[model samples]
Target: MILSQKLFVATLTAMFTFFILPLFFVEENANDYFIGFVVSSVTIPFIFTFGLLTSMLIGNFCHKYHLKKIISFLLHIVSGVICLMIFAVYIFITGGSPEGYIQTGLMIALLCITVFFYIDIVMKKKSK
Candidate 1:
């Protein structure tokens, strides 16, 4: 179940970042689909790899310490902010456009937070 939750969070993050968010920022071009495909090919794997790592770390930490709901929520928020900072630095280092970095960074943060929340919700339901 924990493994499934990790995969779910990674997949959800990749899908939203690759498919949905681009709709708002990318310009229409003859090769736009191809470009998107290329980008996703690169990014999806990256997200999955890191997403799983981060999610597992957080999940294990929460479980090990047996955190309360409010503390867990705060921990997730801090994780999100850390993720956002890392993402921002990554984009800057990669020379990605400034215009898109803010949105991408925020999306990354949201995705990080969503991972914990989704897992918590699912675990709650399972326990019941």
Candidate 2:
């Protein structure tokens, strides 16, 4: 359990870096890059934390209401997939590269860990 918690944190930190690194380093224009950096800094925390917090709350609500974990997880995953697909299309339309989606996946994996950890800290749940 301790190992999993440590590992979860480690993975999340890595994923978060993956998501933010390109925005910090890879813009064609310096001004645009700075804007991206500022945007990333301001938005990432709110987005990651709030999304995790709400999802964890929802998961707890489901658990309390006797929904099976598998079902709840599947439903959440399906919704995530649909959202990711939409994001991918938008990125494509906007001329973002495939690597951006890969990075987005890292961001998502980070958020999943953040959600788990939020529940862990708030509800004292143990990682499996």
Off by over 4 Å in 2: 1-27, 68-128
Q: Which digits, one per residue and each the tens of the lDDT, describe model 1 over residues 29-72? A: 85977876785587566655665676577667878998866676
Listed in order, each prediction's TM-score against the native is: 0.62, 0.41
For model 2 the local lDDT of residue 17 reads: 55
Tell me the lDDT of candidate 2: 0.56
- The digit string of per-residue lDDT tens for model 2 on 19-118 reads 6556534548889777767855865665455544445555667778998765665655654455456556766788987566656564664455455444
- Judging by TM-score against the true structure, name the best candidate: 1
Error of 1 at 49 (Å): 1.3
Tell me the lDDT of candidate 1. 0.64
Query: In model 2, what lDDT does residue 70 have?
Result: 59
Please state the error at residue 28 of candidate 2 in Å: 2.5
Error of 2 at 64 (Å): 1.6
Task: After superposing candidate 1 on the true structure, give the runs of residues whose Cα lies further than 4 Å from its correct spot.
Answer: 12-19, 30-34, 77-87, 94-99
